[model samples]
Target: MLLPLRRALLLGLATVLGQIVWMRLATGQVAWVQVAILVGVTAALGTVFALNFTIGHLRAAREEVKRLGVNEERVRVARDMHDILGHSLSTMTVQLGLTRRILETSGDAALAAGRIAELEATARTALSDVRATVSGYRALSLDSELAGARMALSAGGVRVELPAATDAVRPELREVFGYVVREAVTNVLRHSDAELCTVRLGPAWVEVTDNGSAAGGAEAGNGLTGLAERLAAVSGTLEHGPVPGGGFRVAARGPTAALDPAPSKEGEPI
Candidate 1:
């Protein structure tokens, strides 16, 4: 808004000086004092005009950068919440189902009590995790996920087999690998009617194989899709499909640049 006025002022000063200089030189009567004043005023106004716009542009750029930063933060929070809630809620759903089944029949009261306690524990842990995630303090651990997977799968009456330890995994790859385990097991619990689940973990990869053909149903949910996105962020790959004859397999392999190269699954069925 104000630029044109400032520009005109600078231009007018310069033009007047130019005219005066030409007139004085042509008239053969140059006044050094007048010439100096004209030059000084023109230069000062020119400098002011340039500075005004430069300062304005700098302020505008700063504002734009700040807005972009806020937007990026918002997107990050959204993604975090989606992953956290989706995972925790899905596990809780499976626990609830297990609780219901136990309650339905005149089964062992001790078994029902145990399942109820586990369900309560799962709900409490999820609530705490949600709070932590919102505060950006939550971290995914392969060890924790493994322990939880055993419980979730067991609750669904699926036999569980997990590697004895995950010390072989690189420290940096544990979190994404944890997500892979969580999502895979959650899918098996919520969707399948598998009788057994096999978990295989290498230094740079993790796979969950199950005998559930149509366990809830054969469809990809948001949890699985989100896991794929998370895997991509760490230069990892997610592969899942029904095995040749029967069953389903969900696997994730991390980057080869990590401590150990990704495991080879050359003969694994699609």
Candidate 2:
């Protein structure tokens, strides 16, 4: 790469040469004023060349930065999709297996038919969720997640205790709380064979607790790691570990005060 000074000097030299040739042809000889004019034109060309070169580099640098930012967002979107679909697919797999077993073992047609219907319903719901994820505007609500958790746990043969409504929970915190519920319930479906699961929502916090050994395990997969990152972005906190006696628990807390009380108390991700 040519240094700015060297490039400038070359530009100035070229301009001086062209000016000299023109002056010599136009006038019989070089006048003092012509010499001064040549110097002025040379400086102007040099300065202009240097400035143009600098601007070009600056534009290239800006484009590179923009590309990097876009790439980063793509990575985040990919991670979110993996986490969402992983849990949903796992639940559907379990439901399908149950339906197949019922068909093979149950002598009663009605019982088998019921199980098949459930399986079909679960599959359709999963398909809709996948579509929402693809649209990139999925806004998981605390209410929806709680109801989903109850239905999913029941399907998995786990007893679930969930609140009817989380009206007390601040609106600003609902979405993140919903996310907490989703990942926690997903873990229960995919990894736990627990008999009981419970979800509780508070003013600024939500907790998912289960009486399953898988929750007590020390593994933190991409789902949990990503969950932690999401919480951090909202100035929230996540805690997941084994319950003191049995099973495991996951909890998240939002900001102490409204994120922006003047508006909605909810702020964009940091």
Write one digit per residue (lDDT tens) for candidate 2, span 1-270: 245687767876776777778778997676768668778876777678778988999999999999999987786777668666776676677777777777777766787678677767767876776677777777777787788777777778899989778988888888878878888888888888789988876677777788887653347888888888888888888777776667878877777734422211121122
RMSD after Cα superposition, model 2:
7.2
Compute the lDDT of residue 173 as modeled in candidate 1.
86
- Candidate 1 lDDT score at position 252: 87
Over 54-160, each residue of candidate 1 has an lDDT whose tens digit, in order, gives 99999999999999998876765666676666666777777777767777876667887887787788788888877887787889888999998887777667899
Off by over 4 Å in 1: 1-25, 28-61, 215-221, 240-243, 257-261, 264-270
Q: How high is each candidate's TM-score? A: 0.72, 0.73
In terms of lDDT, which candidate is strongest?
1
- Count clashes in each candidate, considering only residues at least 3 apart in sequence or on different chains: 5, 1
Residue 66 lDDT (model 2): 100
Q: How does each model score on lDDT?
A: 0.77, 0.75
Candidate 1 global CA lDDT score: 0.77
